[model samples]
Target: MTISTTSTIAADAADAMPPLYGLKVLDFTRVLAGPFCTAMLADAGAEVIKVEPFEGDDYRQMGLQVDGHSANFAFVNRGKRSVRLNLKQAGARDVIARLAGWADVVIENFKPGVADRLGIGYGALSALNPGLVYCSISGFGQSGPWAEQPAYDTVIQALSGLMDVTGDPAGAPTLVGESVADVAAGMFASWGVMAALWQRERTGRGRYLDVAMYDCLLSMMPTLVSRVMAGAPATRQGNRHANSAPFGAFHAADGLFVLAVANNRLFAKLAEVLGQPALASAPEFATNQDRKRQEAALARLIEDWASALPVQEAVRRLTEAGVPAAPVLSVAATVASDNAQARGLVVRQRPASGPAMCHVEQPVRFDAMPRGQTSAAPALGADTLAVLEALGFDAGAVNAMQQQGVI
Candidate 1:
């Protein structure tokens, strides 16, 4: 297998405009899913204005904090200006109206009907700006029987059948290490916004997008979805591919390494590397399905060979022989690896105050679009005064609103 590190592209355009340079986004997302969606737009050069409640986003108080900043909040809320508004306050509606009129896009992740109650729903805002693209992220879709029920990442994972297909077959169903459901919803929400934006360019009218975590997560599991649709039940198979043998982690002398042999040709190569080429032609291991039936025996043979070699050596031998293989690595090791550095996967951003922060950036590469211009996440309501003033609130009105706890 060849790994090409570079691609040819045309030179930058004369304007040097960022992908979403002139876009205006009003972000009402607080936690992972909605915040993550808006954050992607901000990274693509949209001018994102994040509106928060007086108490601020819940994530700011939920995760690891350093220098009075939450890592979780910073990771998802970076590159946006923040404004605080008490939506329950009567005076705040005026500000929301002005913001709605000013924004090209608005995204929220409140439970269904909550945004309507707070006057930030699609019907309310789109009325102010008919060209606005409004997106709602939720656990279940709007208008569903379970739409109003509150859900977190774990709840969505469990409900989506993702948890049911993760972990070891012998063990109980387990949650994924990361918040896959939330991330899936965020990704789909961003895609929906972009698609709506493209459509609005032609129609001269905006669209309302409804994104559900459960739906997005379900769509992400192609293998399990196919199996279940074909009359097979979903079941956990640990770190292995459910339908393939010799395609999971195997123990080495020092640690574990994963291998993939998806077809007879790859299995022949793997068998050759193990000095057991005859196994490839054996009736019990002749085809992928046959090998799967004898998976336990196959694993024993491979593990017996690998158990005497270090993981790196085993991985190197397998890779040299052209069988897909890799040593198991921890998160820290993977982030600090040479590949991550060479690809510029992790980036550092410095806020106006506090120590610099490091995060993994979006992986897409555009030849003409420059990357690595990220700023740190804003402090809660840091731009409140400036934003209100920009929306035509004079000093006196701003002061009175603040005094009355409206902002």
Candidate 2:
């Protein structure tokens, strides 16, 4: 749905600056993780300058393209200005140094040593701007035995034990439906940047943040960590939770819906909705532990009752009874749901050319700050001349650098 730009709320929001207004971000990330981090900063009203190679970020050419624009690129790079400069070119180093000096935060996702080689490493930039918060997003981390090894989202998932516990118990390990590793790392990186920024405000010194995809994903899965730490091996349990019974997908007449009966109260509610109130008091199903021990039997009972009803109808009854339940929805369905609409989860931005684009807005709400609106992702180098001129480079100087194949 289109956002109502003329609404009083919209007009008021437009007049108010966001929380990160005036924050300067130099984004040297490509693909998902780094771009995702910077995208959040941009959403908070940071002025993000996305640095790219002459060919632009790899995401521009990596995913589904609509009339030559990469939807994935646009999804993550919204509200950022694009500036193309060849990092390998010596002349580009001068521009990067200036950009780093201008930035309050810098994010890079290159391999650990690549930024150092390019002269945009934390040591170099922080020397120029001691108050700069520098964040490096990587698969393993900035340093470790596996630091130099190349890592993709899938690699991190597998290496981080995420794939090991994601699929059906009887089936082979499976990757998650989306790039959870990249997204987790990006989220942590953004958090790290903000934390560093706050610390800088107190200490009058910036900090270096090393965010690893593996570490972040591992941190996100607290249950898995707790189980392993307790000497219990984490295993795939299909759609069921390892610790809780009646807390996973159940079959309905039309399809699968999920239910969560975490405690005895919820279990009683679920039993009541299932037309089996006595089941909640059964010796084998009384406590959460006892119910988990009979999880398969519990599942059969749930399926038997649910199988007669449609998915949504089953969910509605369970929900109305105070048991957490919901139909399994596709990504598009979730995005377009009434709840999502009410929360303004998806925002529409009209590009200068082509159809309007939809982006998932940053989820947090701040009472004093306005919801952020975004410009479409920039064309490659669209802001280079303007940005350079703003940096005090004359048009002639910028043109000369361009002619030298530096930008």
Candidate 3:
């Protein structure tokens, strides 16, 4: 399901119709990375039971509230059940143990060894349910030199050389605009979970996944790693790439547009489109390597030429000349773009107590042959009673569990 996972997977529900339907996943993750990964499984139709703590996921309090839940929380947790449980309490462990027995997968994002301390670590639970695809996500891996240190997205970025390669030539090194490290790790974890689940069907065994944000970030550092390995100088180019010249943003009369004259052919096309065909074969700009040697002069020429043309016309000319160009669009612009609307990216969701929610639809669309009705995110504790009953907890046990600070 991911771009990187190298495994043979069967065409399960996740790959066919509602991909994750009929599969029960216990999600013990919070914040960006873990939630984002499980959210992917949920979007594909997994019955994700988001097991929250007694105090609830911290993101529930972030952003604008929608019917007692934050929009931030609702966006990622839009199709999962929430059951509150206090894991520190003895009563809660029994409930979690029961859920583990019932669940097909378990995802957690607590700090290193926190789950072990709580007795829900893979070693303990795998003994109870060998078929569970247990996954743990953290800033660092469960074991290593820096496993126990506190980490945030920025810390990982700084430590992994991502930040060092992500800024303007002379600008301060910037963290990625979004939590890319967390997102990458979550995505990787999700891929691992699905692979493990599919493998379990054939092997009748589950796998434990250990995805660390720092390691994920490091894995994504292609250009930076290459340069470091080769001992090449890495400049701080805010919007430019060290791999190629004329591959950055430029301002047109109307707005900003990005262009990537990546190779010699595109560079020639760019020069001719700009009515400077003579520059196409000029000694200082003939080859990509030569252009990089004279990047300052080349950039100045592009800026001067781009300044006189309107954004749309400039983009049109470049496009017509076999070059890539596009306006830098904001969220509003993207939502309103003709291409996005045509692709059916804007989906409508109507929660009973609130206004209709217009959110982005699932990015993974089947081949128009999948079947089944979609499921929305569950209300807080909406399925608690049903889940308890299914677990063979009679009425009295349910009541007793609730009274003992467990759901």
Over 4 Å off, model 1:
1-16
Q: 169-264, model 2: which lDDT tens digit per residue?
A: 999999999999999999999999999999998999999999999889989999888999999999999999888897899899999999988899
Tell me each candidate's TM-score: 0.95, 0.94, 0.90
Off by over 4 Å in 2: 1-15
lDDT of 3 by residue, 155-249 (tens): 99888877887877577788788778888898889889988988999999999999999988888877777887899976677767687888888
Q: Candidate 2: how large is its RMSD? A: 4.0
In candidate 2, list every pair of residues with a backbone clash: none
| Model 3 TM-score, 2 decimals | 0.90
Root-mean-square deviation (CA) per prediction: 5.6, 4.0, 4.8
Assess the local accuracy of residue 281 in candidate 1 as a C-alpha lDDT between 0 and 100. Answer: 88
- For candidate 1, lDDT tens digit of each residue in 1-407? 11110111122674445577768889999889998988788777778889999889999997888887788888888778889999999999999999898899999999898999999999999999999999999999897788878899999999889888888999999999999989999999999999999999999999999999999998999988999999999898997788999799999999999999999999999999999899888999888889888898989998999999999999999999999999999999999999988888877887878667776656676566766665678888888888887788899999999998998
- Residue 136: error of model 1 in Å? 0.8
